[model samples]
Target: PLTVLQGYLEMMQEQVLEGATREKALHTMREQTQRMEGLVKQLLTLSRIEAAPALAMNDRIDVPMMLRVVEREAQTLSQEKQTLIFTVDEQLKVLGNEEQLRSAISNLVYNAVNHTSPGTEIRVSWQRTPQGALFSVEDNGPGIAP
Candidate 1:
């Protein structure tokens, strides 16, 4: 994101981006700046989570609603390059730190989008199991290297 912002700053500094081109550059810069801010917040949340082993898992989070928000964010971030499929069980709910869970899920979706090619299909799902609830993010992206 910083790289993106830096590139845009350089472009703006070097030449006068005009009309639609300037608008597009400004829009992209804003998005990247927002992404960077989100990253910083996530890092701070992660640090806090690490320092305190037990995050308050008392809130009853609406899993489906949260997933929907995540889906929307992923769509914006991926800019329609990837096909996003969400299969969420409407009744599924979870007990956890809402912020943490949201952050984790967002990270998973963003990671998939970032790692995959433009045409890759990413699937996110949340369902109920006999023992508990299950959440997953899967994609037709390359496997991690050993």
Candidate 2:
């Protein structure tokens, strides 16, 4: 994706040199470049998280608040075109690395967005299971084939 974006930028630059409309070319270039950057950052973040060991639980965290952060970020990405409904059990608390948990949930939400269609609903919910907290992203979009 980054390479494709770079090629697009180069092509746009060539077009500009040949007297193409500056505004149109610049707009296209900016959008492609930003998308490429976002992809790279997301990949890097996932890689780092995978390479790191599981975080040790040393402090208590408000589970609902953490989930809200993930939902808010996902909603921002959706831009109101898609709805991200979040449901959390009241007074939920946990002991873990809040940031890492948030990242994992964000990744799931991102995956849901990619697989789901515009205007579809993505539901994020969390509850306490017998052993641990369960976080899920449910979409009305097509499900994976078996």
Candidate 3:
């Protein structure tokens, strides 16, 4: 991430400041900066989750409702280039911190939006399992090769 930020700063300095593709360079810089900001926030949340070992994990969270919130938020962040879908069992629930769960799902959606190209489809699903529940993220990106 630092490497990407440095490269973008260099590009902005060399290209935009030099009067070459000024508009495009500035747009790219803004986008990159926003992306970096989101990544940093995610890192911070993860750090807090790790360092603070006593997070109140007793709140009963409705999985389907939380997914709807994530989907709504992701739609705004998705740049209208990708599709978001939900496949949730209406009865699915979990006992966990709501904020952390939302953060985790939001992170997954944000990652799919940034990793996949335009027009890709991202599916966030939750389903009931015999043991508990299952939540999964699916994206139509060029998946990693074996």
Candidate 4:
């Protein structure tokens, strides 16, 4: 994603694209930048977990609110190439690390968007489950080869 963003920036710097094309490139750059930020956060979280595993868990997080934030971020990432459907139960809560939880959910959404073709509908849902809260990311895209 960073490579792609750099390419777009180079093109814009050279004024190789104009008008709506330039706008689109800028939009894509923004999305890629945001994605990179999430990736960095994920990396940091992993390092922290490795240093001290127990500290990574045990937070009382509002899953529904986190989903809402993820949904907004997904919109910027989607860029109209895909449709995002969010099914969130407002009452859902869980015990977890907020940063880790956000990263996991964002990763799922990002994977779906990056893997699927344009016009695909990606579904993100958080619901009450017998065991606890259930968070999912689903899409009608071609499945990965086994």
Candidate 5:
């Protein structure tokens, strides 16, 4: 994006493009700047979140219900490109920060859905484990080993 911005600026300086071309370049540069700003803000937020203390919201987390809502929200993320599904063996509850858990799982769903091809199916499921509980987001998207 920086390279493209530089090219546009050089073109504008050289008078190689004018009027509508100049407007388009300016708009593109604005968009690139906004995108960069957004990315920087996101990185800062992530840093802050990581540096914070461990989660202390000792509230009951209804796993199934939360996953269902996350699935609904995630559907809008991929829209026509992906399908989101949630499955649970039964109602399972845990204690944690509901907002934190939902955000973490929703991020996984988005990660799976966004990376997969059109018409891909993404599955979000949870089950009881010997240790406690397990949550997973499964997708046909090319993974690290791909």
Candidate 6:
């Protein structure tokens, strides 16, 4: 994608030098640049998540609060077209690294947002299992193929 963006920039620069319409060239260049930036940001985020320890002991995190955060982030990604619904039992807490948990849940929510269509609903829920808490994001989108 970066390579494609670079190619697009080069083409736009050539077009500008050739006296092509400035408005069209600039608009195309700006869109390509924005797409390139978004890809770079997602790559950096993935790298940071991978470099961190998978499991770390730290402060206790409120499951409900974490769910809220995930829901908010998902809603932002949905661009106001999709709605995120979160359901969590009261007094649910977990002992883990807050950042890691947040990242994991956010990733799940992000995936749901990407896979679902606009106006689709994302349902996030948490339950206290015997061993630990189970977090899930369900979407009213196409399910996995059989």
Best-performing candidate as measured by TM-score: 3
**Model 6: which residue pairs collide?**
none
lDDT of 5 by residue, 42-121 (tens): 58767877998987878988878887777777877777688777778667888988877876777677768767999878
For model 2, how does the per-residue alpha-carbon lDDT over 33-136 read when each residue is reduced to its tens digit? 87888779888998998899877877788878777777777878787878788889868788878787677777778778766889888888888889877877
| Clashes, model 5 | 0
- The Cα error of candidate 4 at residue 47, in Å, is 4.7
The candidate maximizing lDDT is: 1
Error of 5 at 80 (Å): 2.7
In candidate 6, what are the lDDT values of residues 69-102, reduced to their tens digit? 6667777778988888888986888888887778
**Stronger candidate by lDDT (1 vs 2):** 1
The residue-by-residue lDDT of candidate 4 on 1-146, one tens digit each, is: 98999898787788788789988998998998988997798788778867875654678898887787878888988898999999999987888778767766777788788778998899888889888778888897665468
Question: What pairs collide in candidate 2?
Answer: none
Give the TM-scores of the predictions, in the order they appear. 0.68, 0.71, 0.78, 0.64, 0.71, 0.69
Order the numbered candidates by lDDT, best leading.
1, 4, 3, 5, 2, 6
Indicate the residue-level lDDT of 86 in model 3: 81
C-alpha RMSD by candidate, in order: 4.9, 3.6, 3.3, 5.6, 3.7, 4.0
Stretches of candidate 6 exceeding 4 Å from the true structure:
16-32, 49-56, 140-146
Global lDDT of each candidate: 0.89, 0.77, 0.79, 0.82, 0.79, 0.76
Candidate 1 total steric clashes: 0
In angstroms, give how far residue 36 of model 1 lies from its true place.
Answer: 9.7
TM-score of 1: 0.68
Error of 3 at 133 (Å): 0.6
